[model samples]
Target chain A: MSTLRTLGSAAGAAAVVGGLVLVATPATAADTATVSVLHGIPNTPVDVYANGERLIDDFQPGTLTDALTLPAGAYDLAIFPADAPDGSGEPLLEADDVAVPAGANATVVAHLEEDGSPTLTPFVNDASPVAAGQARVTVRHTAAAPAVDVRAGGTPVVEGLTNPDEATLTVPASTITADVTLAGTDTVAIGPADLTLAEGTSTIVYAWGNGEAGYDLAVQTISGMHSMPAGVPGGSAGLADDTSSLPMVAALSVAGLAVAGAGVARVARNRG
Target chain B: MRPAAASAVLGLALAVGAPTAWALTRPEPAAGIPVEQALPAPAAPAGAGDLPALPTVTARDAAPAAAVAAPAPARISVPAWGVDAPVDAVGIAADGQMELPDDVSRVGWYRFGPAPGADGSAVLAGHVDDREQGTGALYPLKDAAVGDEVTVTDAAGTATRWRVVSRQVITKQALPLDRLFARDGAPRLTLITCGGPFLPEFRSYRDNVVVVAEPVP
Candidate 1:
C-alpha cells in the first residue's frame, strides 16, 4: 500500500519529500527491466525526480512516457508542482523504496487515491505471450473510488477491487462492454464503454479520477505476444523463376562435392 | 576392393563434407551458443554393440499435482524430420536480424513472440546445417510434408501438438518481412530454415523454406 499524508500548504510539501530517503538496493540483475511513468492526476503538471536527479520536467497530466530501460533496483521518486523554484518547495507526492525486478516491464503512476489524495502506484505489466485467439485484460483501480466490481458483458468478472489494486483475465478476443460498480451494489460508477481485446494483446484499463468529482477511464495496450501453431515464412519471392541463376547453381554443386569428400574422411577417422 | 567398402568410404566423405556445403549455403548461427556446440556430434562406428537402454520417464506424469501450470517451452520435436532438439530463447541482434540458435542441434524461439501454446504466431528458426556439423536438427525440414506432427514440450513437461498446413520456398530477398514476423494472427506455428538454390556469390541460400502449422485442437 502507498503512504499518503495531507499537507498544510505547498511550502510544507518539501518537508515531506525530505523526510524519507531509504537506501535499499535490489536483489538480482538477471535481466534489464523497462519502466514507463504515467501522470494521471487531473490538472496537475509535475516535475519528476528520481534519486534527487531531475528525470522529467513539466510532465503533464494524463500523459505517459515511453518505456525506458532501467537496471533492477530500488528508487526514490518525488513529484513537485511544475515551475516551482528549484528546491524551494515540497513535492506534491513522493514514494521511496520502489522495488523494480529484473525482466519486468512496469509503469509507475502518479495518481489520486479515493478522497483525492495523491499517491504513487507501481504496476507490473504481463508481457508473456498469450494463447492463440485470446486477449488479456487487466483492470486497475487507481481512481478516487471505493472497492468495486468490474463487469464484462453485464457479468461480474472481477470483484471487490479497491484503489491501487488490479485484476486480470485472459479471455477470447472480442469487443466487450465493461462497467464498474460499487462493491455490493449495482449502481454504475463508471463506464458501459466498449473495449476491443485484440488477439495476442494485453489491454490494460485504468479507472482514474475522483469518483465524487466524476470518474473516467484510460486504456493502454501492449502487443506482440502471440504464438503461431506452425512455422511458415510468408511473403512473395521477387524472382520469376529459379532459372535466372545458373552459374550460382554450378558453384553450389562443386561445393557440395567437396563437402561430401570431407564427410568421408571424418567418418573414417572416427571409426579408426 | 569390395563394393561395401567403397560405399562406406563414400558415405563417410559425404557425412563430413555435407555440413560445410550446407553452411556455405546458409547464414551462420547467431552469437548465442559456442561454435562447437552448434556443430553436430560425430557419428559412432557402425559395428559398435547396441548401447544399453535407459529407463523411460515422462516429466508430466512424474510432476507434482501442484505443478500443473503451463510451463515455458524447453524443447521442440518434429517427428517427420526425426528432429528432437533443445529450444533456446533468442532476441533480435544488434544488426536487427532475429538472432539464431547457438546450437545447430537446437531451435531458437523468437523471444518477442508468444510462447508456443499461446495465441498468435510463435516462430522457431534453426540452421539447415553447420560448417563443421552436418545436417542440423532442422535440416530435414526441407522435406517435411503437410500434416506432419510437431510437438513442443514445456519445462513442466507438458507437450502441445501442431500439424503442418503449408510449406513454401521463397527467395530471401523477397520474403514478406511483415507477414513472416507478425505478432498477432490466428494461432499458428512457423518453422524456418534456408532452402532453394544455394548462391555461392552471396554465401547464402537464395530461398527460405517456411513451414506453417496450426494447433491440433
Candidate 2:
C-alpha cells in the first residue's frame, strides 16, 4: 500500500509536468487501448525498438508509453541504450514472438538487467473480440509481471509500467471493425482506453508519460499518443494565437515611437 | 535623460538603415537569493476557519529583502474563500519559470497559473513546508474545504480577489486534467500541493490536493 502511494506520488509529479498517462480499459469491439510502459532504469535514455526499427529512441527512463489501436498479431520488440549496439556497447535484449490477439490489448514487460540484458514478458487475454465500434481494453499486472512494455501497431512505444494499476493505453486504429480475438480471460485487467485511430491510414504512436524528463519528453509523449480528435491542436494553439499577435504589436508600437520622434525632431529643426 | 540621449543617437542612425528592434538582455537575479526562489504561501485565505497559525517573526528579519529587493504585495482579502492575504510583486525566473518567494512555509503564487486576463482557470501553487524536513505554509492546505476564499493581490499592479469553490486530492495517474484546472467558467484559481500522506523515505507527498476558487462579484 505504501508502495502504491509512493508510486502514486511519483506518478503525480510526472503527470503534472511530464505529459499524458494512459490507463487500461475494458476490451470491446470498438475499444481503445491504454498502453503504458516504463524503463525501470533511472535517469538514462532507453531506445525502444520494435520490428527492428527504433520507435522511441533515447526515451528517458520511467516515463515512455503509448496507447495504440490494432487488429492484433505477432510482433517483435527490442531494448537497448539510446546509443544502441555501440553506446551501451552491448548486444540487444530482445522480447520477440509477441502475439497481440485481434481487438484485445496486450502488455509486455521489458526489464534491462545490470548487465544490460533486457527481458520481455506478455499478458494475453482469452476473450473473443466484439462485433463492431469501440471496445474497452484493460491492461494490467500478471502474477509474475516484472514491468511494463508498450507498443503501437507493430512498433515498440511505451516502457516503465510503474503503475498500470490506475492507467490504460488508448488503443490505436485497425482495419477491421468487429470483435478482437483474445488470449485468455474475457475482462482486460488495467483500466479503459481513450480515442480510436483509423486503421487503414498509417498512424504514429504517442505516449502520455510521467517520468520521462528531458527535451523529447513532449515530442515522445505526443508521438507516442493515440491521436484523439479534440485533444489535437486546441488550447495551446489558442495561447499561441494570443502571443502570436504580440511581436507585430510590439513592432508597430516601436515604429510609431520612431516616427513620433522623427516628427518632433523636424519641428525642432523648423523652429531653429 | 541619458537614456533619451542614447535613443536620439540611435534614432538618427536608424534613418540610414532598417533598424533592428531593441532587444534588452534578460535581467539577472539579486544577491543572497537563488534565481528560482521557493514558492511562498499566502496569508490565511478568507472565510477559511481560523487557519492554523505559523511561526511569527518580529518584523526585524524582513528588512533589506523586503524593501528594494522585491515589490511588496498588496493587501489581499477574500470574503467567500477565506483568504485575507497580501501578494508581492515578482519577476519571471531566469529560466522562464515563475519564481515564487523562497519562503515555502506558506501558500505562495505559482507564477505558472493563468496569467491576468487568461480565458480559463489560472493557477497558484505553494508548499506546506519551510524546509525539507519541516512543515511550513500550505501544510494544512489539504484541510481547506470547498467554498473557502483565496485572493491574489497583484501588488505590481492591481489587487484581484478569488473565491475558493472546490477542493480535491488526486493521484498523479488521475491528474486534475485541463477540465479541472482550465475550466470554462469565470476566470478561476486552482492551488496545488503534494499532500495527504507523507512518504518520508521518498521525501515527497502521496497525493496532490488541489484547492480551487473563482473570482467573486
Residue-level lDDT tens digits of model 2 in B39-155? 122222132133222111111110011112223335445454344544443323444233444555334443223353344455455444534335444544455654565556655
What does the i-RMS of model 2 come to? 28.0
Compose the digit string of candidate 1's lDDT tens values, residues A163-206.
77778899866788899899978999888888878667888888
Per-residue lDDT tens digits for candidate 1, residues B1-217, read 4444565556555554555555576532222232122222333322213322111211111100121223567899886778899998765554445667756778888765667867656778877765555556777766667778999988878888998766766667666554655554566777887766655565556677777777898
Predicted complex 1: DockQ: 0.03
TM-score of chain B of 2: 0.50
Quote the TM-score that chain A achieves in each candidate. Answer: 0.70, 0.33
10 residues in a row with least lDDT, candidate 2 chain B: B58-67
Question: TM-score of B chain for each model?
Answer: 0.66, 0.50
User: Candidate 2, after superposition: displacement of residue B107 in Å?
Assistant: 4.4
lDDT of 2 by residue, A137-228 (tens): 33332212335444334233344443333223334233211111112323222222222333112222222222222111111121211111
Which 10 residues in a row give candidate 2 chain A its minimum summed lDDT? A228-237
Regions more than 4 Å wrong, model 2: A1-272, B1-102, B106-113, B130-133, B180-185
Evaluate all candidate structures by whole-model CA lDDT and list the values in order. Answer: 0.65, 0.38
lDDT of 1 at B133: 56
